[model samples]
Target: MKQDGDAAVNVPPCFISNHEGFRGSIKNLIRDFVVTEIDVGGRRVTAASANHTSPCASSDANSQSSAQFKQESDASTDCDVDATPPSFDLSVILGQSVSEELEQFVLTLKDETTAKQELSLGCFPDKHHRANVHRVVRHRFPFLMTITIQPEIRVREDPDYRELSQLVTEDEAEDFFRFIDAKVRGSSYTFGPDDSKEHRTAVHHFMSRRFGKLVETKSFSDQGTTAITVRLREQGRPKKRSGEERKEEEVYTGFTLRKENLETLEAISYMAAALGVLPSDFTYAGIKDKRAVTYQSMVVKKVSAQRLEEKAAEFQKRGMHLSQIRSVGEPLRLGRLQGNHFDIVVRDLRRHGTSDTHFSAANAHTCLEELVKEAVENVEARGFVNYYGPQRFGSSQSVQSDHVGLALLKEDMVGAVRLFFTPEEGDDPHSHAKRHFLQTDNAKESLAMMPLSKAKERLMLRALNRYGTGPDGCAQAWLSLPHSMRVFYPHAYCSRVWNEAAAHRLTTLGHRARRGDLVWRQEGQNKLEDAGETSLPQIHVVTEEEEQQGAYKLGQVLLPMPGNTVKYPENSMGTWFQERLARDGLDKCRFRVSSLKLNLPGCYRPLLACPCNFRYRLQAAEDGRGEVMGGSSRSDRQLNGQTGEGKQGSLVLVLNFDLDSSCYATICLREIMKCDL
Candidate 1:
């Protein structure tokens, strides 16, 4: 008997519990699913838990000692007091008399009214002359900044270089140069992709010499030609500070982030934008579900508590709240948390294969409570199959993330790109752009049509336009995505295989410590804390004696996701892994993609997940009166409005449980409900 939803990802159909399941819908409203993070120190972070103290709070003597050490370190690097500043003449090197312009620009810097000023030294077409000008500005005038301006090239039509070579004439050549001059006022030159590396290097050198060493040159391919843009680097000089002040400055601000109906990245992006910092500057233990009210710990580098507090109102308007703003010695890293505590309300409950008529108004509450109690008790005793939840596959019904991963593993770059850009059904915001690209094969035009919120799509489109859709181009396109997003595709594929393998193991051999099964040694479990989320855990195969003695429980048994480094079970399950990979057009060796640096040395996951501190209650959900524990009345109003209509007197199973990091609460609910989620 296969599970109702097993066909989508080939999950195991068996259930650990033998009790009758209750019928209900989860996530009927956002507040119905509440998640709170548990920190490594076993502290559950809630919206109201505010810690004003800093993580680095220490004795005054220690602080003074650190400050003194910093002062000495700075003193050691100080230049000699008698050293003389270098001087040079810019007029001779620039081949012009620009002393007046330089003097005027310097004068503006002293005025409080003038915010910024730039002095453009005339362009030098000669490489040697440009080099001398750059050298003079750096050593002689250390305070002044310089930049090289490159001409922007817009290709009117795709040019055939072979045909152009045959039709070129002296007048046409002069006309082309004249057009360039008209476009950019004779500031720079353009080169084709076919240009030799040495030629491109010479061009770069000429630009650097003509401008200054501070100027940066970047190359991009457009329509079979490489366009190099030279511009001033935007980095500013660091503010001078005393060594003691530097040591006293807090490096990070730790806070508890409470958000509703928002993804973790989305919330972080909003905060980063408001704080005038990149999203990469913020770090967190794990990603939370988007359709739930979640509370998690987050830390941002160099951001102050006051700054974060000022944005509290704005965040609240967007369904997010920040609290516990305090100074910390270090940023929060992924997997630093112990786990998450969930408060889930499964509503409109009924017995499986029974209708609402089965529960008359007289005994509705009593019947539902008995059913829920039995199911919860079974889960508490036996636990549930630790299958990767449906969300892991993806929200899309048309295309799954694992599909893209398989394409990448098979070295089908073009296929992978297409799969990533494939739009979902019914009014997808990115559908217009994706369809445009699929139909016209014009990445540039499609990019213009794409929304800024579709960052991954836009990133791929930009790379496709600049790099083309060949193997190397596609690989580069994937590489251009953020590391977190890039790893998701391959990781999704690993999850799919792991789910199937785990299901097979339970179905074939039962959830028990088999002789060939692998389990984490005691020390290996200890290393899990220090290894972080990305690192693999150590494991060893169980011996016959250990299996007979029942040294390892089902929860200790491990299953490997397909990877080059992972060890499969030493039984028929191991052969099943090889067969599954063969069907997917892959072998163990293919898991390592050196070009992309995507070496999926997959890790082990337990076969069973038992929820801690588990408890449940069957509540009478009346019309316009449904309430969620730990949720605001306003949120309860929203939930009641959405799910309470015509659901009066219906029973709701409110379950409270704590799960270890990476375990899915949905799987636990699935075993109790025993129906498609």
Candidate 2:
């Protein structure tokens, strides 16, 4: 019914169906082919069918394509699944070295000269590029290359003084004190149970074990407490006591201060107070030199004498003891004694080939002199004030985990209430474990929801690269450097990531560590409601020159108050910390980087594993001219029969600063001094 010229037979413009039958029309729609009739030279008519691929197809064919698409998608998903594992465990503690890396990273920003800098792949300042280069070195040659950094140090005080003091232990308590009777002049003394055989044996044991060669008694008595009489001699002869003015107080009764000097005695008294013991119980007769070993007597109160003796027994284990006790009714007084004795031991020393071991001792003596002078100056400058140091509550015993715990207490809940009643090792290791577990689970979920957080940060950096102008991408630029400077800024990014992750884990998993109780609004009144109790307020710490000076002035004005109450809250520490940061001009200041100095003393020859280069020597010349190794061994000697340069031992010198309480001085010193290699 339709002719080839008919416009009603609408088809694709690329093809014209010349099907003369109904079957041909159906076939043209089913198959992707075109039917056309062409005339050559306007003489003959020809029929042709052209086959091609069709974009449009049946539902079954589309379903097959979708299935193939899903297979490829699954393969890609599996590959990505292996990239981010569930967990990681690194044994190393990323500390000071990491901080230096971060410092270098910041310094390398190219647009740092400008107000703002853009972060990108390649464009970075020298310092930043060096940082990245160091990171690469660390990744590639962890063993061959080492990185060292300075640490951010902060000091803190303990808040459990009252609770720790009041919680007494039986082992540290006293027993009954026995009074020795001397008024009745007895011919012989016997000690033990009232039985004759037991009394003789007890008397012999007491004379042998208790008195030793220090004291000799003629006789002893045993009732509830034993009594011993001293056989006194006068002018190389035994003397008889006159029966006049027989004082009962002359018999042994209680303990008293053995110190002779007033100032040291007062210092010890104050120290005892900090230790939660009475001045009477902290008796030492003569003031021992601070630089030497000294022995003195400490008295105990009659009521608490037994417990004080027990505690003294504990001190005895640590080279301190109650050598003797005397009855001083009005409590122990200072300034009535002789000098102290000292025995010193020094070991494991390093000696120079030129200097004897005695020289090292002399150096130590000089060091000690300087140390004592500094201590005296510091005390004098501070006006000899008395304040509790870190050791008052054994804070020095805590390690890095304590710091982590402190941060958690400020930001996590579980850590806030995790009670460690005693200062023992690994106390409550799992206290924060469960909390961290929960937080990690939550973080996993929440961070996923915020995946765009990282993506956006990266995108922002990239956009800055294109539109903004500033510093080079110090983050990545270091990768383009040669081998030497590659380890300059090692672990910069990784440390930051690790710290952030750790903080996040602690805050999320640990207890909610709020600074203080929540603020409450008054109900039906203008007055505020009660808030919950919290730990002691934290002190504001400032290290900048101006701010620190200001703080020092403030400290001078603020006198010590009783108990732990203070003018500021713990939350103020961070705010003041920010002020110090601004004062230091750290946000804008530039740093001059240096390389690490390594010493290799006691060396036979330089090894390949060593990072240091050795001095080389030249052999004799073949020509008439003579060649000297190290400028001729003969010329090596200079005036006074000494070489121009003396042989020096290899030693690694690392300069750093540590902000810690006086009590934790040993902790810092040990960490620095304990490095053998």
Q: Please tell me which predicted candidate would have the highest lDDT against the true structure.
A: 1
TM-score per model over all chains:
0.64, 0.19
Writing each residue's lDDT as its tens digit, candidate 1 over 1-677 gives 12223343435576888898877777877778888887754456776743322111222333323311111101111101111211435444443456556656666654748724345565432222232344345344434434433100001111222222333333433333333222332244333353455655665665455433334566777776775554443221122346244332345788889898888877876777678876667889988988888989998876777888898889888888898887654677777775777878777677787655434334654676567668888888888888887767666667898999888888788899888878777665578788788788788999999987665677788899999878888998888765556667887898988888887888888868898998766421222222112334457788899889988888778898777777898988889998998898786455876777777777778788777656565445555555532222231111122232243455566777777788888888888887766
Model 2 regions more than 4 Å off:
1-297, 303-320, 330-346, 351-418, 421-677
Error of 1 at 150 (Å): 59
| CA displacement after TM-score superposition, residue 140 of candidate 1 (Å) | 64
The digit string of per-residue lDDT tens for model 2 on 520-636 reads 111121331111111111222223443433423321111111111223212433344234324433222112112212111110100000000001111121122211112333211
Give Cα-based local distance difference scores for all models.
0.64, 0.24
lDDT at 280, model 1: 65
Candidate 1, residue 298: the lDDT equals: 94
